[model samples]
Each structure stands twice: as structure tokens, then as C-alpha cells.
Target: MSTMTVRMNEQDAELVRKFAQFEGVTISDFARTAILEKIEDSYDLQELREAIAQDSGERFSIDEVLTELD
Candidate 1:
């Protein structure tokens, strides 16, 4: 239970209000969800970057994977 105040230009505030109403959510809920989604997106991008960095341009066949599972 906390309160956060955000300052924006009138045009931006109106846009957000309209969008939240269109989506049938309170502005607070819409903003919260948007913030959380952005955070998740950042984490996902970081993981993708790390995986790409670790990739050695190597490919494994299905048989090789199955044999290693034994």
C-alpha cells in the first residue's frame, strides 16, 4: 500500500487516461503492468544477449544429444 505520483505533460496524461479507459483498467493498474512488463523485457533481452555471447557457432545433431542423455 504505497502511493506514487508521476508528473507528465497534459497531453501525455490525457493519452494515458484514454488508453487505460479503453483497456478497462485504472490508470494505476495500467501503469503498474506496463512498468513490470518493461522490467521483464529488460531481463529477457539481457539473457538473450548472454546466450548469444556464449554461442560458439556450434551445432549439435539430435542423435548426439540423445546419446549424451544416456
Candidate 2:
């Protein structure tokens, strides 16, 4: 186990506390989950970039990716 210190603006801290209460978790757990989610998102983006770098020059255009949204 490890411990760390975090400082937050009073208003932001209060909002986190309220949200944590609503979610039935401690404020610390809520913050940890939020931080972990951001880390996972960045990690996924990095992996996607690596996969693109390994591609054999074929690429999808923005239009191709967005066409399904229409």
C-alpha cells in the first residue's frame, strides 16, 4: 500500500465530496478512479499511435471514419 498527498481548491474539493457521496464512495476513491481513467485513456491513445506507426501505409481518411456517424 502507498499514500500520497493531494491539494485541491476548496470548491472543487467540495464538489468531489458531493459526487463521491452520490456514488457511495470516499472522496479519495473517486479521485483515484478519475485519475486512473485518464491514465487508461492516454495509454489507449499511445497504443493506437503505435499500431498506426506499424501500418503498411494504408490509412483511413477522416471522412471514412466519420461516415458511420451520419
Candidate 3:
């Protein structure tokens, strides 16, 4: 495991502490989970953007999907 140091203004620190306390987690745990979720969201957005940019004009409707499944 590794350690990293983060500095924040007192107000922001207090907000994080309060939220952590409310969620029954240590400040570090809360921050770690928040950071991981944000990273995952960014990756998902990038993948979506790439897919959209690669669009080949193929189109589908709900009925078409259901008929194919049937």
C-alpha cells in the first residue's frame, strides 16, 4: 500500500469530515471511494464518446430489437 497527502481549506475539510461522519466511514475511506467512482465515471464517458464518434449510421428501433429477440 502507498500513502498520499492532500491539503484542503478548513471549510472543505470540515465538509468532508461531516459527510464522512454521516456515512459512518473514516474521512480517508470516504475520499477513496469518491475518487474511485469519479475515475470510473470518466472512463465510461470516454468510452461512450468514442462509440458515438465511430457511429456508422446504423439505426435500430425498439420493435426491431424485440422482433429479433423473439
Candidate with top lDDT is 1
> In every candidate, how many clashes are there?
0, 0, 0
TM-score of 2: 0.70
Candidate 3's residue-wise lDDT over 1-70, tens digit each?
8887889999999999999999999988998999999999999999999999999999999999999999
Identify the candidate with maximal TM-score. 3
- How does model 1 score by TM-score? 0.81
lDDT of 1 by residue, 1-70 (tens): 9899999999999999999999999999999999999999999999999999999999999999999999
**Global lDDT of each model?**
0.98, 0.91, 0.95
Superior candidate under TM-score, 1 versus 2: 1
Per-model TM-score, in order, reads 0.81, 0.70, 0.88
Candidate 3 or 1, higher lDDT: 1
User: For model 2, what is the error of residue 65's alpha carbon versus the real structure, in angstroms, after optimal superposition?
Assistant: 19
**Residues 1-70, model 2: lDDT tens digits:** 7887788899988898899999999977988999999999999999999998998997788999899678
- What's the lDDT for candidate 1? 0.98
Positional deviation of 62 in candidate 2, in angstroms? 21
Which pairs of residues collide in candidate 2? none
